[model samples]
Target: MKLPVLSLLVLVASCATPGGDAPATPAEMAAQARTALVHVEQPDPGSPLLQVDTAAIADSVDDAKARALLAPLLSQIADLSLARTHVSVASADWLLQCQSLRRLDVRACSRVDDAFVRAIVALPQLEELILARTATTDASIDALLASASLKRVWMWKSAVTPAGLARLAARDGLLVDAGLRPSDSSAEVEPKPEFVNLLPMPGEPALDAALVPINVNCPVTGAPVDAKRTRTVNGRVVGFCCNNCPKTFDADPAKYEAALPKP
Candidate 1:
């Protein structure tokens, strides 16, 4: 007797591979993670079961989701971006397990603070970190300073003060990006030069001209520097995005000077 369509479908489904509903393997977990909107890279398609090399869960991933999604692939993840997630210090335990993690981006994860930074800095291979818009302060800077493998840290918009940035920048080869340079008009000021030269001199390479600011963004506001608004400070030219930024720099030169490229 011929079976009904539903029965036939069930029969076929029953005959399918065993363990189909069993616990997922690492590769399967990666596929499932991807389905949940986590961006994962296997790096080598030829090896179908290869572990994921990179994973970005920039969505609203909290501590529980972070643990669930990353636990299976922690060993292989080299680059991870948790930017904009809701993860907090509770997720740091799993992040610390990412032994191979080289770069991490937790930018905009407001819940992440100095405690989280302290934990992740222990990752032996962590090299670059992006912590912009978080609550981390100078304590985070102190934790980051102890990381032997860290080469760059972007902490713009955090609580790190200019003094904190200077301390971190003092570390050789460590790049520190502390949001817009701070300025206080009330702070003690230096005498402005009677005549400041803003133009590149003849026969000078524009790229290397002393009047050309080494940074493309205004040190005071982190905005695109306007070539016309330039000032010579300590023999180096500094550029500002607007007339007001130069004034801001003039008010407190030392605070902004740390943001300029080191001599």
Candidate 2:
């Protein structure tokens, strides 16, 4: 009796045969996605300018897959535009590969840090660097100053200090935003409460008056007391040296309460 071979064929097709082509690797899948992104050409070889809108891929792929796919392609890229994405330090290998890179925009990439700044210094052709709304701190400022080719750096909302900006301004033509708190011209100055004047003990730095009332270090991070940035727990004000310190303290205020002075 001749059985229908069509059923057998359908069964074989439904089952993924091992001998048949294997599935595409993560890197390969990423490469296919990357090829569709906006590509702008420059006078350099291999069309060095690459604009990666990672925001487009964020929903589709995790960070590892994206890095594996894009890292190899950055070897010849000169200009990389990464807006609104977390570029982790593990991807440093690919960024450092851009030897001819001139302009880099990392706006709103909070994951970027001082190490990224140090790595980019190797790019001799780098001229304009935008690091707005990043976690980059004073640690990267000296490296920026040392760059012979860097012209303008925009670091608005970065952790850079006023002192660091002053040093950068001393350079002949380098431009940097002050990132200073905007003053309200229309607002009238309110008189300080008597308690405010009474808070500071005699013979301390004037700036200390604005810091939290703590003689000892922060129990959480061991940072010096900060008068300006504080959190009140159990009807007592506690000082924190860094912006994130209070968060650490708040996770379990009871744990650090013993370390704090009586209010």
Candidate 3:
């Protein structure tokens, strides 16, 4: 007996594979991901594995969508870029399953905190990590130190302090890009003056010309001091590079005090 067209189509679809239509091949999954604006690259034309890059569609991807798109391809993806996406710690947990991932970029992902760092560092094959502009702080650095395979980390604009960066830099065979090169850390390097004149605030007394600043450089920023911007702290005169530096110094005088030259 002849079947209706709709029924025939269903029968054909079921017969096409033992179960429902066979689960999508890695190549097919890659194509599907591309249709969603995710950039997918195969090692070669015929390779089933992929390199998923969501940077182009970062604004559109949230935690749920990230899971949906990456769950099936986790094993196949060697390099993944979720840079600037809205993914949080929830999505970061999925990365632990991605053992094949070699390089991962989460740059500018504000939700990537120490918790997220702790999660992804568990990825055994992760080699290069891009955490620049994220919320990861010094604690994240401590978490990353446990990773055996991580070789490089980019942390410019991150919450990591200079000390944290220094600790990470001390690791053997690990490269850190914190917006400063090895030469920039030299003790002999002189601080360049960013601003010269420091106008006094309304009703504030003018700076004393005869008074010398205890520190030749702005302790807070490591910039050349503006002679006109001076403040007396703990019976010592401190100088700053620009008008803003004084405010930063005021907020936490003790923190910057350590950089000042001692008597």
Candidate 1, residue 114: the lDDT equals 96
The parts of candidate 3 lying over 4 Å away from their true place are 1-22, 44-48, 182-263
Which 10 residues in a row give candidate 1 its minimum summed lDDT?
Answer: 48-57
lDDT of all predictions, in order shown? 0.75, 0.64, 0.80
Which lDDT tens digits does candidate 2 get at residues 197-237? 22544786555433445435676877776666676666555
Please give the TM-score that candidate 2 achieves against the real structure. 0.50
- Cα lDDT for residue 57, candidate 2: 44
lDDT of 1 by residue, 52-114 (tens): 322343554678666665666678788888888888899888888888888888888899899
**In lDDT terms, how accurate is model 3?**
0.80
The candidate maximizing TM-score is 3
Q: Cα deviation in Å at residue 210, candidate 2?
A: 67
**By TM-score, how accurate is candidate 1?**
0.56
